[model samples]
Target chain A: MELENSGRESVLQIALLGGVYNNYLALEATLQDASQRGCDEIYCLGDLGAFGPYPDRVFPLLDQYNVTCVQGNYDDSIGNGLDNCQCGYTDPRDNHFAQLSFDYTLANTSSGNRAYLRQLPKEIRLERYGLEILLCHGSPRRINEFLWESATSTQFLEYLGKQHQADIIVGTHTGIKWLRQLADQRWFCNSGVVGRPENDGATNVWYTILDIQTGHHGSSKRRALENVSWRHVPIHYDYRRLACEMEQEAIPTEFIETIRSGWWTTCLEVLPGKERRRGRF
Target chain B: MTTPKVSLTHLDQLWFQVAGTLCNLTCHHCFISCSPKNDSFGFLSLDQVRKHLDDSLIAGVKEYYFTGGEPFLNAEFVDILCLTLEYGPATVLTNGTVLKEEWVERLRKAESLSQYGLEFRVSIDGFSPESNDPIRGNGTFGRAMDGVLRLVDAGFLPIITAARTWPMEQDAEILDRFVQMLRDSGYAQPRLKILPTLQMGAEEQRTHGYLDSERLTDEMLTDFDFSQLVCDHSRIVTDRGVHVCPILIESPDSRLGETLSAACDDFPLSHGACMTCYQFGAICSNPSGQAYRVKSDEHGT
Candidate 1:
């Protein structure tokens, strides 16, 4: 019956990748959207915690929805066993602040949650709605792969070639929602980071719904992904409340300040200072 | 009122990944997360590199560069460098951990043979092993120094590139420490290039990546210094194709086109790192020493 429903309806397949830490309101809204849209399945790509005020609130919701999530570097960092977040990025300075984010996240996550995070796979390959899709936190080659729209087509093709099977490679971690097709082989899309803005300075987080269909475009049996739409779903949450919680959790002052500043220190390109609100501060 | 004409030019620099995605030591913060097991980007054959060099020569390219998991890891690195020097002044960017005495001698000999200069840029994250080893790998500092010393012995003054993971205020002390280390290693005038880490790749996990706000829109380039941007003039030739700039090789859009001629179009100002390049002109080139220099006490102090 479920299989029949998928065929009859242009069932939109949706997967939630990492960077969606603890914005329960956003998560709930997405889940609600999924339920309303007659979406077949919803998957959570890890990172489930960090930077947000609530890890406890976010994890159970994921389970409740049966969202398939893989452990991101932050998820591991929050698990308490790993010496570092193992985010794959390194600081020559061996920064105290970077390590602090890991500490606070670990202190907040529960044992049961840690076990669940520990069990998540690095990459997942799925044939959803008859389309070959590769779902990963970063790239298929490595976990925490930062595949941005700014990357070269050749670089995308290289990863696409490595897949040998995927027609579409979807990733998270770049906080920016991007969708692009590379020749006939594959389409690389990032679900964008739910923890922050979508790099466009918009406060809305990103999520995608792909309506897959079996069609013959040329002289071939091709499963085409149609109506691939992404929305920067905006949810107004009490950020001050989240910031205060982060501060109370003894997360680094910088980490807390990041929540306040709404600026990621690494990229150094994005994040406009909210001069409009400066006088209020 | 008239808008200034924005003209795109031929790619002046051609960067090639000689040894592909396989590096000798896996740096914890490698932007591409390149390692021994990672062969997603394969080493370019000498013939392949020569083909790109031929393309560059025809296109009148101004510079050439070789980068890799570790460029020296390519067995034909010397041959590739020799081939590159024939066309233009070449720079081989390496972590400087695996420089062999024989390889250094060959490089010097090749430089002498060509009218164009051959430069070696070493990747040195920190001045000390304690600081560098934890991030690069254990015993990497000592090995890197050996490589640097060998280049010095061979009469090739290598430019040491250190990614500034430290605060901006602390740059003077860091540069001083770095210069002192280089002097102690016996290079009379130590050339250093301080780089800011692009928070992508393996480094993304080591730290948070670019924020949602950290991206470049097309209009931002209007007031921005696009001339200094590597993508403005340089193109990288990988095993598969030519890329816009060396920094954005991992990006699918980084590939400008297959050849230098094909890449000679106005590239859209994309990537958050392009903002960094725009903020500071010509992050890849400099007038004093090479393309870029570290914050020196002479300037910063």
Candidate 2:
């Protein structure tokens, strides 16, 4: 993804999308929404294929919208023809569904697209208004790590910020959106996935918009931290269509159920107690 | 062959042997042979835990885990949990026999008030008393079930962690039965964590101990991701000192140092338990724990 900004503008609003998961319909709608909202840039934290059908469809939309992307675990696996999506679900039932999804996506993803995924940077570092923003699929330390909100400590996020040398760090892998501002004015954002609902018994998925007001010359760290604000924008797409498409592709019914009902069915094992309790499953 | 060595990648998980080797009920398969009389280790005071919590913050420890003979056996268990919830997510591993409704109620409230999760992992051996009582102890099953009900009533979804005492082939059937049993007990949405048995301590007498060959070797580490091993990313703080992991606390060599920083040095994976950890990655951690799925062949797909 393009990290270099042409100039330090007064205000910069960027759209951050997480794991599309082959949900081209959501991708299309999200692009339109982001454009209509007048976002200066759009970036997708990857996993461009999985769950939803027609793996190749997401690429054209991403290209059309110029959405910069970072490689996710699923993308890394698919791009390299790996045996499984490195999702870290240890349960046999979860692994069964994960494998099914991985095989389908790997078989369906075009060679060119796979190569594109293989080359996508694991992380993207951007300098905006004196703010060093780091975007990664999971935590910067590991590609497939699940940094769940309830389980992740503030100190840990701060450590990640310092370790990665970023004022603001954004990642999407746990499929839940959360924002935490650390004691040092550093920020961590998990831009929730558009691939599926957040298992919160809500059908709508989400993305995030980070608005940074950067015009003040020689802005202090406090001023820059204050200028940054993020909003989790719930994106409503044609769930019925995606579910039907998944059904047509013979994707597991449990996955389709998650798309329709917004509660995860297969990968419930990896959820932390609090996140699991929030889900209907 | 030389023993494989694993180093701490980061202090991701900091465990506390809170109640230490002092459990109310001594199970047949107690890995540490902890019992009412076995006070080889001692309970960590609230101040002690607070100190570790402070130390953990500097190390950027992701989550805190409290295990014991039974963490709830400690008088200040609830206070420790509540205090931990303020700093980060906390998970307590208990036998479920000693859980009080009042404690659960306070914990539920504490979790709600905090930004992090407070997980209660209740240990049970089997689906029914016939199977579980024999291992955990006679009459312990009923008491544990009562504790589970109390936890559920207090709005907590306690993860029922069962050691795989039965045959591996029976895993699916056993897990299904456990889920059904939990549901019957009024836990509508039951969460379960199935654990592989660690052959040590009292378990060595109850079942066969690890064979002489059961040890991690240097050759085994060639392609394996050491991160899967708990020692690669975790350390347990005991009243004695910070150890390599909770499973190997009894071993003298497991005591890496007295402080979290000193314990970050590499450890030789020579114990029989290291073989079990190699077989089952991150077995000591919650399923939601951080993991890196290293490809067996990094160069190949």
On DockQ, the candidate that comes out on top is 2
Candidate 2 structure lDDT:
0.87
- Candidate 1 lDDT over residue span B149-177, tens digit each: 88877776677888777887888789779
Off by over 4 Å in 1: A1-9, A23-25, A92-94, A158-164, A213-236, A266-281, B1-50, B53-160, B163-301
Model 2 docking grade: medium
lDDT of 2 by residue, A75-137 (tens): 888988888888888677788888899999999999999999888888889988778999988
Query: Model 1, range A1-281, lDDT digits (tens) per residue?
Result: 01223452644556454577665656766667666666677776667776566577887777787788765656655554665554433223323444565566677778998887777776677765456777777555445444444222333333454434677777776566666665554577777666754434334455766555434333332434442334333444455666677777665565555555654443221111111111111
The docking quality of candidate 2, as DockQ, is 0.55
Identify the runs in model 2 with alpha carbons over 4 angstroms from their true place: A1-10, B296-301
**What is the DockQ of the complex in model 1?**
0.01
Candidate 2 residue-wise lDDT, B1-301, digit = tens = 7776886878889999999999999999989999999999999999999998999999999999999988888999899999999999999898888877778888899999999998888998999989999999999989998998898888788899999998999988888899999999889888888888999999999998999889878878776777778888899999999999999999999898888878888899888888998898878888888466545223111
Chain A only, candidate 1, TM-score: 0.77
Worst 10 contiguous positions by lDDT, candidate 2 chain A:
A1-10
